[model samples]
Target: MQPIFRVQSNLLYQRLEDALQQGLELRLVTQGDRFCGVPIALDEEFIEILYLHVSEDEDSPEEDPYARTVWVIRIAEILAVAYQQSWSRDKLAQLLPTDAATSEVEES
Candidate 1:
């Protein structure tokens, strides 16, 4: 997974909301070093996650290698969301186009 963006704790919900509205997939990593898949649902206290994993060996047709599952957790557990470096709003804002920068100023 590529490291793209890091959202501050205070901005986490707003960033997640924007991502959800844009139909973006986000991989959430916890402080415990666990990868808790894409967020499929969220609430004030918890978030529902969906993760996919594929087995390395293709030994038997009966043994399905692909697996998907959901995990739910409180917001306090999350540490970061994996994203492409270029897509990081906080990091890339200084490099934005003039018009976009203008819009940012307007928003502020």
Candidate 2:
């Protein structure tokens, strides 16, 4: 079956499309009180995010690269899908999260 992918924000959806077309990766950063990051992985229940963490000048080592932090977001928390794409079955199967509803449907 074809898989459905969705992004919640129009701006973020645009950025993701641009990044994919340009062969570039998006970096998630902190903006005032908000946090932004790319969606690296997802499952039926959670989305795994990888965001850059810059250490304070006082705490950062002279040559240290930025750190990456992984955050798990609940699928229910996602507002909507800003963009959708059809993915190969193999790829979709690998990335799609497994959940009780899905399991029940598959079993029946």
Candidate 3:
């Protein structure tokens, strides 16, 4: 039988593959932080992503439309990976005006 870590890695690979195929945004949790991005490439050791949002500190000062940076995270460093969920229109309609301001809190 394969080792437990190997089995878990295989599962993680499969999930990343599915996410890539579906063009789903993913939230990857690592030891220290989390990242959200669309999978651009995947391999045994790394998953590369086009970041959905780059922080100001990390953002490039030059506004070049053709320039893009791919963020690569080690598969081993990822503790968990999950697709970002979209709010349904019906659910969005139920949200109060103040809900938008509080949305960030919900994630925490």
Candidate 4:
């Protein structure tokens, strides 16, 4: 059966998109960092719910764009999100670059 099309109540997407649109860099801790567009498009499942896509960008001392791309991830693996705090300069420094704002987060 086709999933119902609905507006995502995901405050995450709203915030991120707003930040991005306003040219503010958002620090997202995800698996993959790149996507065809948004990790999930409109009318897709998980609408209104903030679903995390694993970013491909693994922060290394070396530059790796492939590591930073974003992909849909399982809910089980996420330990946390940037809910209460932003990434540290150290954390931000470690992130690989996919766009103007995103940085690398090396695997722990």
Q: Which of candidates 3 and 4 is the stronger one according to lDDT?
A: 3
- In terms of lDDT, the best-performing candidate is 3
Quote the lDDT for 4 in model 2: 37
lDDT by residue for model 2 (1-108), tens: 332345545444455445445444344433322334556764545555667877778765668757887776554454443333566756766676777447745886
1-108, model 4: which lDDT tens digit per residue?
A: 653322266555455445434444333444653222233322233311233445454664344333333444332232233423367765765563555234223333
Ranking by TM-score: 3, 1, 2, 4
Flag regions of model 3 displaced more than 4 Å.
Answer: 1-9, 54-69, 85-108
For residues 22-104, write the lDDT of model 3, one tens digit per residue. Answer: 88888999999888889999877788988744346435564643445578998879999989657775565466466763674
Find the 10 residues in a row with the least total lDDT in model 4.
41-50
Please provide the root mean square deviation of candidate 2 (C-alpha atoms, Å): 16.0
**TM-score head-to-head 2 vs 3, winner:** 3
Per-prediction TM-score to the true structure, in the order listed: 0.55, 0.35, 0.56, 0.27
Q: Global lDDT of each model?
A: 0.68, 0.54, 0.77, 0.39
Worst 10 residues of 3 by lDDT: 1-10
Off by more than 4 A, model 4: 1-7, 31-108
Candidate 2 achieves a global lDDT of 0.54
Error at 16, model 1, angstroms: 2.0
